[model samples]
Target: MTMTMTKLPRDLVEEILSRVPVKSIRAVRSTCKNWNLITKYERFANKHIDKATASERDKEFLVIAGDYLFSLNLNETHSRKFDLSINHRGISIAREHSDRTVFIAQAFLSQGLLLCVWRNVIDNRSRLLVWNPYWGKNKWIECPMTYCLYEWFAFGYDKSSGRHKILRFSSNNGDRYMEIYDLSSDSWRTLDAASDINTIKYMESGLSLKGNTYWYAIDYEKEDFNISLSSVKEEKLAVLFSPRDRFVIDIWVTNKTDPDAVSWSYFFKVETTQHLSGFLFENFLIDEEKKVIVIFDIYGGANNAYTISGETGHFRKVDLRQSPYKRPYRLVGCYIPSSVQI
Candidate 1:
C-alpha cells in the first residue's frame, strides 16, 4: 500500500511548508486552494517565519553594500551567495524615482519590518520606504518639508495603539524639534521627546528590540562609551563592548529590556584582530548557540566583514569586494520581517 501526498497530516504539511523560502511562499500558495488558505493564517505565517529564521542552515541577513542590497548567510562558504535587493522586490515601490538610481541610504529593522531611506543618484533626493520582504509588500512614505539635514529616523511600533510609527529627529547639529510619522493616519506630527536628545547615526548600531527602539543614555559621570548595543535573537538585547585600550571584546545581554527597566549580564569575551579596531556598525548579527558573532564595518573608506568566535576567540575577515559588484560594503544588519506590512 502506498501513502499519498494528500494523506499527509495537516501538521506535517505545515511543517514542510514552513521551511519553504519566503520568496517562494507565493508559489507554494498557488499550488492549491487548501495550501493557499493554510499559508494565510496568522499562526501559520508566524510559525513559518520563526522556523525559517531559527534554522542555522537557512538563516540569511540583508546587507546594504555600495549601490546595492544583498542577503548574507554565514553558514555557507565565502563565494557566491543568496541575494535579493530593493530592485528585485518588484517595480512599483521605486516607480516614482525611476530616473534616479536607488540605493539604501539607511536601514533600520523593527519587528522584522525594514524601514529604509532609499537615496537616489540623480540629485540625492531621498524616499522613505517601509518594506515587508517576506510578503513582498512595501509602502513609500511622503516626507514633510520639516525633515532636515543630519536627521536620524527610527522604526518602531506602539503596543498600546497597535500601530507602527517612525521617529525623526535632528542629529549632529540641528533643531531641537522632534517629529513622528503615523502609518495609520498617513501623516506626520510633532514629537517633543527631548531637546538635548542625541541619537545614534546611520553608521552606528540602531537596535530595535521587541518592536521598539533603544539607545544608550549618556552617563555624565562616566567617561568612555566602548559598547555597541544590538538585538540578539530578537528576544533579548545584546551589547558588544570593545575598550580602546584592550584587545578583547566582551558580550553582554539583558533578559529584561524596556524603556522603564533593563539589566544586563555578562555573556563572554573574545580576542580580536588588530584589523577589528573599528566600531561595530548597525549591521551585525550574533549566533547565541554557536557562540559566534558575525560583524560588519566600513572603516577608512574600506569595506570589510569579520567573524569572532566566543568559544575559541578565533578571528577571520571577508572583504566585501568579493561580492559580484566589487563595490564597497556599507553593512546593515539582518532584516527580520514583521507580520505588519507597513
Candidate 2:
C-alpha cells in the first residue's frame, strides 16, 4: 500500500522527525517530496541537528547493563543498547571477531564511525576496529604493541591530509607516540613528535576538535597536569600546562567557534573529591547550544557516577544504581579511542 503524506500536518511531521535519531533522518527525508522539502529547509535542518547534538551530549554515558552496552539517549525516556555478545546478526566487525572474546577499552562515536579497541582472547593481542553500527560494517586494524598498553587512546580526523589518526602513550616505556592510519591508502605510519615529552608521563584522556587531537597528560610524579594538542596533517605536537593542579580534566571543541583559533582555555576541569586520588575521568558531555560541559566521574570506592558542569565547578551526584537494567560484572571506565562511536 502507498503511504499518504497529506494526512500528516507539517508541524507534526517535523516534531516526529526531530524525535528520530540523526542517523535515520536522511532516509526519512527521502521518503517523499514533502519530507525532502521540509527536511531541506536550513532552519528545520538546524533545529533537528541541534536537537540531535544536544541529545548526544546528555546521552554520553555508556554502561554495560545485562548483556548489552546501553547508551542513554538525551531524552532519557528512550535508549539504544547494543548486545555485547556479538551475536546480534549484523554486519559488524564485532560480529566478525565473534570467535574472539571482545573487551572494549574505550569507544566513541564521531563522523559516522564507531572506533573501538578489542582484544583477541586466544592470542591476547589488541586490535583497533572501526565499525559503522548503523550499517553493520566494520574493519579491523592492528595496533602496535607499544601503543596498546596505555589506558587512554584517541582517534580523530586530520583535515589537512584528510587522514585518520590515533594518539596513545606507551606506559611500559614512558613513550608517547601517535599512529596515523590512512583509510585511503590502507597503511599506518608512526610519528616521533610526542616522543620527546618526558614530564608528560601518562596520557590520561583525549578530545578531538577541528581535525586535531587534544590529550590530558600527567607528570611522572603525578604532581601536575598538562594538555597536548597535535596536528594530524603536520604531524606536530604542542604542549600546554593547565592553570592549576587539575585532578581530572576533559576537553571539548565547540563547533560554534573557529576550529583552529579555539583555545584550550575554554575546556572544563573537575577537581576530584580527594587530592591525587585514583578517580578516573571516564567521559564528558559538551552541550554546544547551552555552552556547558557535563563531565562523568567514576570513583573506585562506590563506583558511583557524578557530573560536573562548566557553569558550576561543584560535582553533583548522579544516581545510576536505580537503572532498571542489570549492571556489568564490574564497572570500569577508561579512556576510549575516538574511533569507536555507535
Candidate 3:
C-alpha cells in the first residue's frame, strides 16, 4: 500500500530532535540527509544538551573500569561497555607480569569529553589522551616530561571565554609548579599560583561545578568568617568535612572567589547513629533541590551512596550493585550526557 506522509518543518523537526535522547538521535540521523545534517548542527546539538542536562533522568554516566569504558544511566542497574580502541594504538607498552596488561591510571571528564592518563607498568612512559566515546573520537596530547614523576591533572571549561583548560600540578622538592593547557590554542602555559608543597600534599576529591574547579582537602584549614561572607554573588564554594575525632559530617560554604580567600563557614552538621565504622567516605554530591547530600562509601567490597537529609539529619545508603573501586584503583565522576560533539 502506498501512503503519503508529510515532512516536518525544519524548526519543528529540530525542536523534536533536541528532545530525543542523545544515543537515539545518533541512530535516527541516518534516516534521511536532512535529519543527518540537523543532528550534526551545532545549534541543535547545544539545544539538545541543555534540555537533557536539565532533567536528571536523561543523564548518563561514563564509567572507567580497569582498561574498559562503560556507559550507564545512574538511575539504572546495567551498564554497556564501549570499544575505546579508537586511540589505543602506540600508547601502550607490552608488560609481562604474569601475562600483559595496561591500566587506565587516571581519568577526568569535562564538557561531555574525557581526558585519560595512561601509564605503562613496565616503564615510566605515560601518555595523556582525550576521548569522546559518544562520537568515537580520541586524540593524544603531549605530556610535560618535567613533572612526569608526580603530577595531578584536572579538566575544566571557562564559561566567560568558552575555552577549555587542563590544570596540571606537580611538586619538585618542596616547590609546586602549576601548568595550564589551553585547548583552544592546543598549548600549555605555566600558571603563577604559588603554593607550598605541604599545603597541597593531601587532597581527597575534586569537582568542577558550573565553570569553576574545587578541591576538597583532607586536612581542613581554618579561615576568617566575616570577610568570606562579604561577597554578594549567588555562587559559592561548599566543602564537606568529616573529622577524625567523631562520626559527624560538617558542611562549609563560602562566597569568595579568590584562591587565597578565607571565606568558609560552617553551614550544618550530620551525626550518624549507624555504625559507620571502617567505612571510608571518599566523595559527595549535593542535591540542593532535595536538601540532601549524597555520600560515596568505599568500604570493603561494598560500593554505596548514602543520602543524608539536611533538615532531619537522617541518612539512607543506596546500593549501586558494583564497587566503584577495583582493588587499589577506583573511578569517580558524574554522569552527564550531551549532544555536543567533542
Residue-level lDDT tens digits of model 3 in 1-342: 553222657888889878887656657777878888887777887888788778665644344445556543322112321111111111122222333444556666666666776666666555677766545557677767664455666777788886777887777666677888887788889888975445442333244545555554323366311111111112455566564556777776764555455466566778887655445544444544345566556677566657677777866666645344243223345546544344
Q: Comparing candidate 2 with candidate 3, which one achieves the higher lDDT?
A: 3
Query: What root-mean-square deviation over C-alphas does model 1 reach?
Result: 5.1
Error of 1 at 150 (Å): 1.9
Off by over 4 Å in 1: 1-16, 26-44, 50-56, 76-103, 119-125, 171-174, 199-205, 217-226, 279-282, 334-337
**What TM-score does candidate 3 get on C-alpha atoms?**
0.70
lDDT of each: 0.66, 0.46, 0.56
Q: Write the per-residue lDDT of candidate 1 for residues 195-301, one digit (tens) a residue.
A: 44553333453567776777665455563546666666667887777766777778888979877899988888886556455645444667676667777666665
Query: Per-residue lDDT of 1-342 in model 2, one digit per residue for the tens?
Result: 765556878888887776676546547777888887787666665667567655533223233433344443222112221111111221223334544276665554445455666655665566777764433456778776563345456666766766666655444465456666665566777766645434433333344444454444445555554333322112222232233454555444432424445443344454554443343333434333333433333445344444444444555455555454424312212112222222
Best-to-worst order by lDDT is 1, 3, 2
TM-score of 1: 0.77
TM-scores of all candidate predictions against the true structure: 0.77, 0.54, 0.70
The superposed Cα distance between candidate 3 and the true structure at residue 9, in angstroms, equals 3.0
Candidate of highest lDDT: 1
- Residue 200 lDDT in model 2? 38
All candidates in order of TM-score, best leading: 1, 3, 2
Whole-model lDDT for model 1 versus the true structure? 0.66
- The predicted structure with the larger lDDT, 1 or 2, is 1
